[model samples]
Target: MKAENLAKILKNYTSGWVSISKNYKKVIASGRTLRVLLQKLEKMGNPDGYLMRAAKDYSGYVGV
Candidate 1:
């Protein structure tokens, strides 16, 4: 898979909460690449968690 294609997929996935449903789970379980990416993202934290908060703050320049 190309970077552009992967980016497009991820962009689409991140567009809404419903995107993380069973279909997405099936996609992640379909192969190693997504599993590894999911692991890395987990290590970085996720799902309304700290890393997401930090990302929001960083992007919004709330406390630069």
Candidate 2:
């Protein structure tokens, strides 16, 4: 998926760790931390995904 499009989807998330589906077509789960997110995924049978964080303020935000 395009970065621009992904950004649009992520904008809907105010805070938390977001798990993007393997196909990048949808959000698998979201939680306040990796452990929480992983637990949620475990309940869902642990589908593959990528992790990303959502901020309260995106402006001027920098991630390594």
lDDT tens digits, residue span 1-64, model 2: 2333466557678787988876667888999988899899999999898888877676665433
Q: Give the TM-score of candidate 2.
A: 0.71
Question: Which candidate number maximizes lDDT?
Answer: 2
Listed in order, each prediction's TM-score against the native is 0.24, 0.71
Error of 2 at 44 (Å): 0.4
For each candidate, the alpha-carbon lDDT, in order, equals 0.29, 0.77
Error of 2 at 58 (Å): 5.7
Estimate, for each residue in 1-64, the C-alpha lDDT of model 1 and write its tens digit.
2211123223333311221222223122111354454565566463331111111112333211
TM-score of 1: 0.24
Once superposed on the true structure, which residue ranges of model 2 sit more than 4 Å away at CA?
A: 1-4, 56-64
What is candidate 1's CA lDDT for residue 7? 31
